[model samples]
Target: MKTRIATAVLAAALLTACARDPQPASLPPAPSATSTATSTAVAEPCASVITRMSERERLAQLLVVGVDPADPDAAVRLVREQQVGGVFIGGNATALLRNNALDAVQHAARWGVSIAVDEEGGRVQRIDELDGTLPSARTMARTKTVDQVRAAGRERGAQLRARGVTVDFAPSLDVSSQPDDGPIGDRSFSSDPAVVRAYGLAFAAGLRDAGITPVFKHFPGHGHAEGDSHAGQVTTPALASLRTVDLVPYQDVAGFDGGAVMVGHLTVPGLTDGVPASLSPAAYRLLREDYHFTGPVLTDDLGAMKAITGTYRLPDAVLHALLAGADQALWSSGGNVSAVLDRLQQAVDSGELPATRVTDALGRILPAKHACG
Candidate 1:
């Protein structure tokens, strides 16, 4: 045993000698002082508390649920009890003073949770009062200039960031191919995929510039769906055609750092039989492999889609979502809090959802927090 241990120690010493030093012993001869400074400075590591949160705390980082701003006590209870990874403020919460909302959200952030908002213009505006009046996405699209969209996005981002909103679920990338899509009609840029791609990229860049992370939403195209996803089933056409059109913008912006995606609840028969995109292995696979999307993936709302809720119970939805490759699950109703947590914990215990995956998501969750904080 001693001989073996001695051999192992000597081998470890040899490997250590071969490893490259993390901090350079000497600085590179540089073209300029600025270049040298830029090259030598490393990014600040994540906060130690965030890195070392308990299993429950880490799990909390995977949620972005709704809360009522009027009920401050209830809101605090939700945060303390639900172990939410984050809270997504809706119009109900947005109606409060921006500073008050910031105070509430930052309080959640202090416990290592993210604070997010919709803030998509047109019918989807949440923080319009804080961000100046928001223009409909259709109006921006009508300008036919990336600059128009970028400017609006930047301003919206700045305002939200000022209020401690870390994630802005904006720049609806779905191409409104079916002009009759009720919820997504003018909210979409245009029927033309190329135009949407250009505008979406510009908008995403603008949000990044304003120090807020943007989430590309309704992936695999909500444009082709015939019915609304809020109630019943909404199916789309072929995945091939949808990808080339509705998904083009998403593909274009997938490489942007700090840019994540929100998978809608709509089902595409061509992609995953009848499963909603949020729980579709097919959709997640496409996002991961085809689009090469390396950032986090979140559900639009687990409680909103019948395709999801009908097929799986709250806990089942949570388990299947993680299994299907979603990094986080959004629940709109506060009643589902315990169910969501129990489901996630059950998944972790069963080995169906590995702790490593949950931890990996926890790490990604932090960057968004730091970006917003």
Candidate 2:
């Protein structure tokens, strides 16, 4: 009886650890970078494998290009040709989600490709048409207990994983009270940072339970931004004001395992100078240094968002995002795979973007991937 109790206690402890540290037991750590791998077993020693990859492959691994949901062949071709890290399955289309199209894309990669989606639920979900509905963050907070919210996330996550999704960009960590339909409005769990932290972590844990990596988004906080980056450049409150409220939920994520962060395009008065957070070195520095977040840092959409397009083209935006310290740059409009790779190669050849940075990005990326292939 004592042995049975001890065994149960140990199993519970390990499961708790698995949620915070996703690295598989069999994989070797990436050179000079910490491993952020999922707890699921993987066939390859991916971290060690990344060190031997080509310079261009290393750079390619830093991008998560968009894939049209209606067309699956394009995604497979893109990864086969460019050896890019992952493909973003965005928008409301259900064609790709309906079949095993993603499996073909996954097998096309020599390494592996991460299949990511924005499944935050309610106004922002990718698979609800086929799987079922999920309440918005506000509704989840107001109507359900934290445990219920976690269960909902787990159920939705399992559904997405079944559809070949490996990463979910969800559970907005922003603290806000804006109108329900505004940019962050109901997407945010609550205006209270503490509530955001509790509900956000609960949702994240649920996804982790289902073997889907949960990405805590709009880092440094997007809840209080003055405008929507989807339409135009947005600015946030000064760094000091952010530190108390908007930035509070982030404090819990630095140590969270099997997770990632999405940096928004908002410009902060005291931190970003005049650049959006997605393109600012200072903003990344704060996330890396001040917050001590070591997981994969991804840039929010740079292709369609006006804040990025208004200032730079796709190629230049990708370059800027890399130099700004993002592990991967997401462009969800779904084209320009070859053109963008060519541009990034040119930047590397000219020493505009250092080779070491590419390798460092790969170190974080390889370990963080859910290995859909």
Lowest lDDT sum, 10 consecutive residues, model 2, at 28-37
For residues 39-99, could you state the per-residue lDDT of candidate 2 as single tens digits? Answer: 2222356656865778778778888877767667777888898888888877666777877
lDDT of 1 by residue, 1-373 (tens): 0001122332333244213113334322211111110011112464465455676667767877766544555666777666677776554334433545556545644555666767767667666555556766666888747986788788888877777677778778878844432668777777888887888778878888898878888888887777777566778777877866777787666568888888888778777766777776778778877887777788887754555555556556665666666778886544566656776777677665676666556556666666324
lDDT of each: 0.66, 0.78
Model 1 sits at a Cα RMSD from the real structure of 17.6
The candidate that wins on TM-score is 2
lDDT of 2: 0.78
